[model samples]
Every structure is written in C-alpha cells, then in structure tokens.
Target: MNHLKKCLASLALSLGLAVSSAAAQEAQKIKMGVMQWETIAMTSSVTEHLLERHGFEVEEVEFQEWGVAFAALGKGDVDVLISHPDYAAADYWERNARKLEKLSVASYGYNAGLIVPSYVTINSIDELNEHKEKFRGRIIGVEPGSGMMRQSENVVNEYGLEYEIIEGSGPVAVAELKSALDRGEWIVSMYWTPSWVFQEFDIKFLKDPKGVQEPTETYVWLAHKGFAVQNPKAREVIASVFVPESALTQMTGWVKEGASIDEAVARWEKANANRLDRQAMIGNQ
Candidate 1:
C-alpha cells in the first residue's frame, strides 16, 4: 500500500507540472513605452492593471526623453506608447510616421507656454518686460531640452525681454513655483496645461500674441506596426482608455506628491469605476 501511494503522488506531481508549463506558454505578453512624466506613469499603470485582468502580461519601458521612446517603438522593443504626437513629439512623429500606427487619441487640450501665479498681474508674454525686475529677471523653466523651454526662449527673444532662462527639472520648477506662491512673490515660469500642477496651484498661462506657442495638442496611443493585428484585445483596451482633463490633473497631482503610480491608479479607479468600465467597453467595441 505504501509503494502504491508513492507512485500515485509522483504521477500527480508530473501532471501538475505539465499543466503549469502549458499555462505559462499560453500567457500573452505586451510591452509599452512610457516617459517618466506623471501623466504618462499614471496612464501606463492604469492600463497595466486593466490588461492584467484580461490575461495579458504587460511591461512598461520608461524613457527619459520622448526621442528615445520613439526609437524604442521603431525597434519593436516596446509595443505601445501613450504620447502627444502633434506637439511635443511632432518632430519624432514625422520621422516615424510610416513605422508607427496611431491607435487612438487618449487625451487632448495639452498646452505649453509661459505661466505665472494669477496674482502676478501679468497678462501676456509681451508684458513680461515691464515686470522683469519684479520676477528677478529669471524665468524658471523645466528641462532645458523641453519644447516649452525652447518656446520660452522664442518668447523672450520676440518680446525682447531681458530675463534669464533658468534650466531645471520639472520637480525643481514646481518646487520653485510653490515657494514663490507661498511668499506671494511675483515669478514667471515655463508652464503647460493638462498638468496636475495647474490643478494644484492657482496659476494662469500668459497670453502669446505672436502665436509662438502651438495650439493644444492631442495625446494619442501609438502602437508598433502590426501590433493591433497581432493583439486585437490589447488594441481595444488602448482604444477604450480615456482620461478627462480634470481626472488626469488630479491623479497626476497625486503622483507628483510621491504617490506610487499603482496607488494613484487604484485611487482613481475606486472613485471612477463607472468611467473605467465605460473605457473598457469602448475598447471592446
């Protein structure tokens, strides 16, 4: 009887191992590229959760620069990227247009330009010269390579404002903005819209009469060539995901304050379950 029991146990173990191997082989995997920006992180995390529910193993590849993100997509290292093709990525999109497929426009109304606290009494880019001293002749800007900073330089040159463009990171710029606001001091910084900071702080964009800044651009989901053909359900989810301006601002704001991407996504999902379901439905359709 003991010999029979041992044989039965060995047979069961072999069957179990075979089943596990089959399951692993059947599991589908998808890779997505994302930037370190709060919005990108939040969106990518939310998508990851949703895809996992549908039996897909999702991987997020982080790229510091949008340029690198595009290259990864071209090389097929990453499958998808939720990005703004018309504005910040226009140059890259132009180069990779044939290589990538735009699946859907995920969000819109992204604006980039100079901004200041509403109390600063500045209304337009041209008016910066008069209050240059009040702002300490410095325009706090995000990364030097950012399109916003480049446009800011144009604004300075076009308006002939004698201000220095202080190049710092996004977090540093936000910190400076918060400090200036706390002290009720006048300050100008290269800022944008559809950002969590806009919702967190009472700030306004300075008008640009010369149209140096482009109109609001739509952020879209770009897939590697033939990704949709290979993974229809995954494409559906990308199509289904939609983040309104308000929700995006609030969620990204949380991430800016050190919230993990998953935490922020969970919080948003708990509060917006209906919206999440709707997005899924849209994708399936």
Candidate 2:
C-alpha cells in the first residue's frame, strides 16, 4: 500500500509539470506594437484587451516619439499602431502608403491649434498682432519636429505676424505656457487638444480666422504591408477596433487626474464594455 501511494504521488507531480509546461507554451504567443502617443494608450489598451479575450497575448513597446515611431514602423520594429492625423504622421504614410495596410479608423478629430491662457484678453489669433509688443513678438512651439510647429511657422508667415517660434516638447510647451501665464506676461504658445493641457491649465485655443489649419480629421489604425496574410486573427481584431473622440477625452481626463497608463486603460475597459464587441473573434492561434 505504501509503494502504491508513493507511485500515485509521482504520477500526479509529473502530470502537474506537464500542465505547467503546456500553459507556458500557450502564454508564449503574443502580439507586439506601440501607441504613437499617450492619448491613444488607454483606448488601444481596450483593443488589446479585446484581442486578448480572443486568445492573443500582447506585448507593448513604449513608443518614444512620433518621427522615430514612424521610421520604426517602416522597418517593422512595431507590428501595429494608431496615431493622430497630422503631417508628421502623414509624411510617414505618404511615403509608405503602398507599403502599409489600413486597419480601421480610430478617432475623428477637430480643429487642433495654438492657444493662450484664459487670463489674456485675446480671444482671437488676430489679437496676437495688436498685442505683439506685450508678447515680444515670439511664440512657444511644441517639438521642433512636430507638424503643429510647422503649421505655426506658416501661420506666422501667412498672417505676417512678426514672431519667432520657440521649439520644445508638448509638456515643456505646457509648462512654459502655465509659468508664463502665471506671470501675466503675454505668452503665445503651440497647443493641441485630446491632451491634459486644457484640463489642468486655464487655457483656450486661439481662433484661426484664416482657417489655414486642417479640420475634420480622423486618426486610423495601421498594420504592416502584409500583416493580414501572415496574421489573419490580428487583422480581424484590428478590423473590429476603433475609438472615438469622447472615449479618448475620458482617458486623458484620467491621466490628468494622476492615473497611471495601466490603471487608466483598465478603467476604460471595465467602463466601456458596450462600445466594444465581445462576439468579434479572431481565430485562436
């Protein structure tokens, strides 16, 4: 009886080991990519979770910057992504439009542009001209490589505003705007929405009377040139995914309130079940 009991325990241990190995092998499968910006992280996380439910494991790569991300996509360092509709990103797709595959429309966007602190009496972009002296004829711009900065440069030329654009990243631009506004010193800076800037700072988008900026844009999800063929399941999940402006805004609000990326994403998934389709199944890989 003692020998039989020992034999039974050995068999159970081997079976447990086999089960663990099989589970590890199943978990080893995954999809990989980056969210081009923090704005899309939470929403994409929802898509990621939806894909996971459909039997996919996801690996996230911290997308460093727009330009680099685009270049990386072309080389296939990342497998899939969503980005705002902007010239910086447009330049990438325009160059590789034939090489990249369109997945689905993610979000539709509105007028995005430069803004000023609410305290400033300038309700219009034109006001900058009259108050040129107070501003020292200068404008703070987001990252040098950003599409908005390029547009701001054109605005200066188009409106004949005598000002120089100072280059910096989005957060730096916001910090510069807030600090300058606090001093009540005339400050003109680059701005774009779907960001935490409006939530935390007393700012308003400057009116563009000329309507030079692009309007009514839509952000999209994209995959590599031949992703659909190689990963039919990924394509299926991609097709079922898209996020709207309202959804993105809610995520940004959470970020502004000090929620981490993972936390905000988890909250968005739990709160927005209706927006996602659970029946949409990508084949089990």
Candidate 3:
C-alpha cells in the first residue's frame, strides 16, 4: 500500500509538470497583422509557420491598409508585424515611438527606385517631359499614401512636367502597367525592387537627376512592447527571420503567379530549410 501511494503521487506530479510546460508554450505563441502588399507577404507567413512548428501558435490578421496595421500594433491589438522602413513616412517607427516599443532586426537590404517597362522609349526624367504627351501626360502611382507616390509628386514638382498623378491600389497599379505594356503603349510611373514584377519583366530605372528620393529603403519586423516579456522564445525566432534579395524576388514571383500566401511561404520553406538556422544570425536589414 505504501509503494502504491508513492507511485501515484509521482505520476500526478509528472502530469502537472507536463501541463504547465504546455501552457507556457501556448502563452508564447504570437498573433500577427499582415499587409496584403509587399514581399514580406510570403516571408512573414513562412516565418510564422516555422515558429508554429517550434511550438508557437500564429494568428494572422489582414489589414486593408498599412496605416491600419501600424495602428493595430501600437494599440497592442496584434503581436507581430512585418514593417517597411521607407514606406509612407516612417509609419511603423512613428507608431512604435508612440507606444509599441519592441522591434526586431530588419529582414532585407534594398532600396526603392522609379522604373519603366523596357519598352519605354524615354531613358531619363528630363526626357519624359519632352515626350509626355506620348504617354497621355499621366504618371502612374500606387496607393495614395505610399512613399513612392510622394517621391513621384516631388519628381513632377521639381521637373515642372505637365503630368497628372493617377491614384490606385498597388495590385491595380501593377496590372495597369502590364495592360499598357501588352498594347505597346508608353507609360512612366513609380516602381520598387524585391518584387515579382522585376523578376518576370524586363524594366528600366528612369534617371532621377533631382534626387527626390535620396536613399534606398530597408524592411523590418516589429512587435508590441510586452512581446519580449510574454514570449522570449518567439522573440528570438522572429528576430532571426530574413532572406537575401534573390530569394525575396523569387517569393514575389511566386505570389504574382496567384499562389496563396501560405503556398508561397511553403515553397520558400522547403527550398531553404538549411538557411533557417542562418537566418537567426543574419544582421543588417
């Protein structure tokens, strides 16, 4: 009877410990807000799944706009967000400064630039002014609040070009360019790197002699203030997620082809399993 009592007590304690560990892991899981735009679409999803495989639960929230995503992060409505540094006016950083304090390292080292389809006859911004009427005197633009849009505004203002800015969504802008190109029509507009468009289409960067957009941009991951305290393990893995420009372009291509975000992510994960550990040690966005 004494031996049986001792055995029962040991079993109960072991079960208790197991339950406690599982609860600890659950508490460390993350819920992230994702933007439909950007190369991070595939990368973040892949990172989220990888974290889940290691015992974290990922809840993904899709926001209609980048501003909404930043607001959600600042209000602690979400646990993690993949942010763009050179987006419309340090939106992510400003939100972080307001309240959200936790920020992981950046994931890519790249810059945004203005590009045109290779079929474009003009080679420079000055040249555009001369042949502005051939392009219907309109400059294509992405969302109304995008960084490139502002840069395009500056370009037109500085050059004194007689061009009207067309406002549209990111995907729509890409489609517009494609449609125009299909008919061999002339078009000039804002464009950026680390995108599937660059991978699949031959394009040219117009000379920004005025240097309105002075520098290149980087991409980053940010979390709410208490993220580190609540989920140190998740913090470690999230900080380590990153990929090279080449891989980023590939993922973007996968997305442009209509693969779901998760599908694109799985493709990247399978192709780059060996790089997961290296991703943890990568530095410099």
Candidate 4:
C-alpha cells in the first residue's frame, strides 16, 4: 500500500511538470494573422523575423477575410495582425475592438481611391464625370465585397458621378490598368497605395474633395487583449516595428519582379540594419 501511494504521488508530480513545461513553451510562441495581400504578408514577415530574432517562435495564421482575421485576433486565435484599422478594416475593428488591443502603426500613407496614370489630365474624382468619355464611364474595381469597393459605391453615390464600377479581382484591375497604360488609353481604377503598382507604374490617386473615401490611413498592429500582459517583450518588439510606405512599396515591387516575399523582406532588413537594431534595443529594454 505504501509503495502504491508513493508511485501515484510520483505520477502526479510528473504530470504537473509536463503541464507547466507545455505552458512555458506556449508562452514563447506567438501566432500572427496574415492576409493574402502582399503588403500584409511583407509586414508580417518582417515582424515574424524580428520576433524570432528576439527568441520568440512565430506562427503565421493565414486569413482571407478582414472580418475573419479581426475575429481570430479577438478570440485569441492569433496574437497579432497588421491591418488598416482606421479605414479598410474599420468595421471589423469596431466589431472586435473590445477583445483586441491596438499596438502600433505598422506603416503609413495607406490610401485607396480612384487612380489614374500620371499622364491622364484629370486630377480629381469630381472631374471624372467631365471626362466620362475618356474613362469610358467605368471605374475598374476589385472584388465586390471589399471595403474599397463598398467605399467606391459610396463615392459614386456621394459624388453623383455617372460611372459604373466594374467589379473584379485585384489582379484583374491591375491587368486592366496595365493594359490601358500600355495602349495610352485614359482609365480610372479603384486602387490603393503601398502596392507594387505604385512602384512599377506612374499612377496617381484622383483627389477626393468631398472625402467620401479615406484619403490616407496607417496600417496598425493589433493584438488579442492581454497579449501585452502575457508577452511584454514580444509586445515591445512588435510596437517598435514601423515600416515606412516607401520601403513597403519597394519590397512589394521586388516581390512583383520575381522575388519571394521573404527575399524582398530580407533585402530590406539587410539594407536597414540600423533601424532593425534600434527596434531590437527597444524590445530588449
């Protein structure tokens, strides 16, 4: 009986140690939510590298929809995510605001609206109708349910512009823009900045005078509530990360030209070692 009691006690102790070890390991791991968009992917990659360098294991959780991504972060499925909370993902952010925490601005100068090649003479959304014939009374738009598309709908109604927003995927819109530019045809498309297109083509966003759309926004870092309390060091590292719009544009351009996202981010990191070091210092503190 004494032997059996001793053995049972030993088994209980081992189980307790295993559970504690697992918890410790989990604490060192961070799950980051990533979207299919290149900008998000690039920024997420940078954050992942930074966290891993500082001794934390990073796992990227892929999400297709903004609402779903925000939901995941709120539910603790992901520790962190990069998004344009003030504009593009505002609705989602509001819905999950209570369960999430805004960490820092990941990047700035994120703008979305009707864009035209620099060669096009018109410079504002209101002017598009005046040159309807030039633009063929159409606005090339991305996926139908996208935030940008929803905003574009508001833009059309707000401005009372007589134009149709042709709904399609992002790549299709890009292709249409490229084709128009190639043929020297005037075209206006709903597009955004911090994109590879800005680096590759001479395009400009048509000015939104009435401000129906957000003229500029910042991609912010958001995390699950209590993430900071649980992982202060990781939070510091994430908060310290800030990629400029130009850098993100350049990295995205590199990715567009056959470089992998990781390769593009690696190049940026190598060139911006000083910045990375500075961020590391803050994290270490």
Best by lDDT: 4
Give Cα-based local distance difference scores for all models: 0.82, 0.72, 0.73, 0.87
Candidate 1's error at 200, in angstroms? 2.8
Model 4: pairs clashing at backbone N, Cα or C within 3 Å: none
Which of the predicted structures, 1 or 3, would earn the higher lDDT when compared with the native?
A: 1
Give the residue spans of candidate 3 off by over 4 A.
1-26, 86-89, 109-113, 119-122, 133-136, 142-147, 167-185, 277-285
Clashing residue pairs in all predictions, respectively, total: 0, 1, 1, 0
Candidate 4 C-alpha lDDT tens digits along 75-110? 888889998887677888889899998888888888
Order of all candidates by TM-score, from best down to worst? 4, 1, 3, 2
Model 3: which residue pairs collide? 108-285
lDDT of 1 at 126: 88
Per-residue C-alpha lDDT of model 1 across residues 1-285, encoded as one tens digit per residue: 999999999999999998677545542888889888777677777777778777788888889988889998988999999888887788999898888998987777778888899998779988888887899999998887777888888888888889999999878989999999999999898777667888889999988888888788777889878877666667777777767667778877787788877788789999988877776664444
Runs off by more than 4 Å, candidate 2: 1-30, 65-68, 75-77, 84-86, 118-122, 134-136, 179-186, 214-216, 229-232, 277-285
Which candidate, 1 or 2, has the higher TM-score? 1
Task: Report clash pairs, candidate 2.
Answer: 143-168
Question: lDDT tens digits, residues 1-285, model 3?
Answer: 999999999999999988677547546547788877656666677678668656667898988677788788878888888776455437557656656654565466455656778988778888887887788998888889676787788888888888999998677878888888888888877777777777777777887777776365566777777667556667777777666777778877887788876777778788887887465444212
